[model samples]
Target: MSGGEGGEEESLEFTPTWVVAAVCFFIIAISFAVERCIHYGGKLLKKKHQRPLFEALQKVKEELMLLGFISLMLTVLQGTLSKMCISEKFVTNMLPCSISDKHKEESAGNNTATMEHLGGLRRLLSESALSQTAYCASKNKVPFLSIEALHHLHVFIFVLAVVHVSFSVLTVLFGGARIRQWKKWEDAIVQQINDTDPSLGHAVTPIHDHAFIKDHFGGIGVHSSILALMHSFCKQFYGAVTKADYLALRLGFIMTHCKSNPKFNFHKYMMRALEDDFKRVVGISWYLWVFVIVFLLVNVNGWHIYFYMAFIPFILLLAIGTKLEHIISELAHEVVEKHVAIEGDLVVKPSDQHFWFSRPQFALILIHFILFQNAFEIGFFFWIWVQYGFHSCILGKVKYILPRLIIGVFVQVLCSYSTLPLYAIVTQMGTNFKKSIFDEHVQAGILGWRAKVKKKHTLKGSLTKPGSSSTDGSTVRIQLGGITQKDAGEIQPVHD
Candidate 1:
C-alpha cells in the first residue's frame, strides 16, 4: 500500500504539447510507410494489391471503430454511473466509512476546508478491487491534453472504419469487376484445375463469381472469407445435416481410423479442407494481419500494466477454435477407428461415415462459452462503473492511468479487442460469394460435388508411312525439294 502511505507517488497528469504533436506526426508517417509497403508488396507478388490493401483497411477501420465505439460506450456508461453516485448536494455518496467525515464536511458546504483530503475515488471500490489500488495505481493520473487527442483520434478511426466497411458493402452490391473483368479469372482458375487433375471427379467449373474490382478496392478477400465461414457454420446446425449428424460425423471421423482402411488420401484431403477453411475465414491482407497480431500482443502488455483487455483473448481463441475444433475430435476418432475397423470391433462405436462429416456441436459449445464470457465481463464492468470512480475515468479509478496518452491509447485498444465485424458483407450475389474445399468431399448428399461427365474425346487417325530416324530422336524425311525433321513429341515440326 505505497499509495496512501505516501512514499514516492506523483501525479503525472499532463504532458507537454510538443510530445502530443510528435506522436501525431509519427502516426501519419507510419501510415505513409504502410501504404508504400502495400503498393510495393502487391507489385512484387503479382497479386491484386488493391484487395489486400482494402482488406487491411477493413481490419484497421473495424478495430479503430471498435476502439472508438467502445470508448464512447465506456465513457457514456461511466458518466451515467458517476452522476448517479453524486448526491443532491453534489458530494459523492460512494465514499468509504473512513472518509465519511471528510465527505460530510464537503456535503455541509465547508468552503474554508478543501475536500481534496478525501483522496479522490479511492474510497468507493469493493475491498478486493481496492487492494489492487496501491500496487497498480500509486501514481495513476489523467492527462487532459492526451485524453483530448485520443478522443479526436478514436473518432477519426471509428468513422473511417464504419465508412470503409460501408463503402465496400455498397460496391459489392453495385458490383465492381464486371463480366469481362472477372470472367477470365473464372476461366483461368478452372483451366488450371483441368490441367492439373482431370480425374478429380467433380463439377469444378468456374461459377459466376462476382468480383468487386479488378484489383481489391473493396474488402473482397475478407468479405468472401467471412461469408464462406458463416455459410459453413450455418449448414452444420440445420439444413440437410442435423445437429446429431454433425456431432456424429465429428465423433466418427476420428474413431474410424483403422489399419486396414488407411484412406490416407481421404484423411489428407479432409485436413487440407480444414486448413483451407481456416485460411478462408482468417486470410486477410498481410499488412492488416501483421498489424492486429502486433497490437494484440501489445494489448497483453496493457493488461499487465493497467485495466483489463476485455474479451479480446477469449474472443480470439474462440474464433480460431471455431475454425479448427474438429481436428482434435476427428484425429482422436481416427486413431480409435483404425483399431476398430482393423482389429477390434470389440468396443462398440458409431459406424464409420463420410469424410466431410461436420461437428456443429463443437461450434455450438464455443458460441455458448463466448456468450457467457462476454456476459460476465459486461456485468463486472457495469458493477465497477456504479461502485466507484464517481468523478474520474474508469481506468483512473480501478486501473492505473499514469502518463495519459499511453494509458488512454492502451485502454482504447483494449476496447477495440472487444469489438469485431464478424459479418462484414450484407450484399448477396448468389453462390459465387462462397467457395469451400471442405464441401467438395460430400459426393452423394444435397450439397455434394457430383462428377462432371466429359462430352468430347480425342479421335484416332490412320497411321502414316515410316520416315528416316534422326540422331536426336527426331524423324527426318526427304521431301520433294529438301529434308524435313520433327521432334519425337511434336505434332508439327522442324523444316529443313
Candidate 2:
C-alpha cells in the first residue's frame, strides 16, 4: 500500500520548469516567424496586384463601417429603452392603487419581529442574528405590469420600427453611391480603349442577344460563358494592355451582359437585389428571436409547450424541404451539363461540380432554414403580444395598442414597396460614384498624356492625306462601329 501511494504521488508531479519554459519558448518563436512571413507575403501580393488589393480593402472597410454603425445604433436604443422601463418612478407608476396602498401599510408594520418570535425561542436566541430583520414584508405587493410599463413597451416597438426604416434608407443610399462610381470607371475605360486601339473597339459588341443567351443557357445560368470569354479575350491581347484596361474590358462585358438580359418583373428584380441584405438582417433577427423566446419561456407558464409544438413540426418540415431542394438542384445541374456537352461549346463548360452538396453547404442550408423559421416565429409572437394586450385593455384603459399597430403596419408596407425604387436609386448612385472617382484619379492623368502624344503624331501625319496608303501598300481608313470606310463615298453600315 505504501509503495502504490508513493508511485501515484510521483505520477501526479508537475512538468519540470525547463521543459515547460522550452515548450512555451518554441511556440512563441514559431508564432512570431509565422506572423512575420504572413505580413511579408501580404505586402508582396499587394505590390504585385495593387488595384485588386485596393478594391478588396475598400469593400472590407465599407462592410465593417456599416456593421459598426448598425451595432452602435442598436446598442444606444437598447440602453435608453431599458433604462426608461426599469426606472423606479416608472415601476411605481405601473403598480395598481390597491397594491400600492397595501404595500405602504405592510411597510409601516413591524411584522418581521412577530414572524421571528413565531419561529420559537431557538430562532430568537441565535447569537449571530441582527436586531433588525433583513427580509422585506412588502416585497410581493408590487405589480408586474403597470400603465408606465405599457407605455414604454409601445415606445420600444416604435423605436424598432424607426431603426428598420433607417436601415433601409441607408442601404439604398450606399448602393446608389457605389453604382455611380462604377459608371464613371466604365466610361473612362471605354474611351481609353477606343483611343488607343480603334481596331479592338469592334470586339466590344452591344449585348442585345438576350433570346440567344436564354435559349443556350436558360435563366440566370452559371458564369461559365463570361469566364470563358474573359479568358480568350485576355489571351488574345496578352501583354498589349495595362492591368487597368483589362479590368475595364471585363467590367464592360459584364455590364453589356446584364443590360441585354434584364429581369422585367419588379418583384423578381427586388428579390435578387435584396437577397444578401435580407439574409444578413434575418440572421440578426434570428438571434433576437432566440433571446426573446428564452425569456418568454422562463417567465411565462406553459410557454415551453407552445415552443415545442412549433419547433418539432418545423424540424420535420425543414428536413423534407432540404431534401426536395437538393433533388431539384441536382436535376438542374445534370440537365445543364448534358445540354452543354451536346452543343459542343468548347468556349464554356457547365458548372455541375459547384452544385454538389458538401458538409459546409449543408450546414449553411440548415442555418438558412432556422433563420427563416425564426422570422415566422418572431412575427407570430408579435401578433400574440398585440392580441394579449388588446384583450387586457379592459374598455380602452390601455388605449395605445390600436394606434401603435396601425402605424407599424403602415410603415412596414411603405418600406416594402420602396425596396424596388431604393434598389434602382442605389445602383445608379454607386455607378456614378465609381465613374467619378476613376476619372478624377486614373483616367484624367492618362488622357492628358495621350492627348500630347496624339497631337505630335497628327502633325507628322498631316504631310500626307488622311486616307493615303503607306509603303506596305495598305490604305489608311477610319473604322467606326466596326465598319471601315475605304473612301467617304463607299461608306456602308455593318450589321451583327
Top lDDT prediction, candidate number: 2
Worst 10 residues of 2 by lDDT: 127-136
lDDT of 2 by residue, 440-459 (tens): 23435534654675665677
Model 1, 1-496: lDDT tens per residue?
Answer: 2455633333334545777789899989996896677557656533542333344444544455455566777566543332222212322222222244446535764343333443333323223233333323444522111222234333433443343343333322322222123334334433554576545554332111212111111232323545445543433222222222222332243233222322222222222332222222222233543543443344322143223434443444335333432222233334333442332112113321312233322332333233323332333233334333333233344334334334333322321221111111110001111222123322123122111111111111123234732243433232321122345341221111
TM-score of each: 0.26, 0.23
Off by over 4 Å in 2: 1-144, 196-496
Give me the overall lDDT of model 1: 0.32
Root-mean-square deviation (CA) per prediction: 23.0, 22.0
TM accuracy, model 1: 0.26
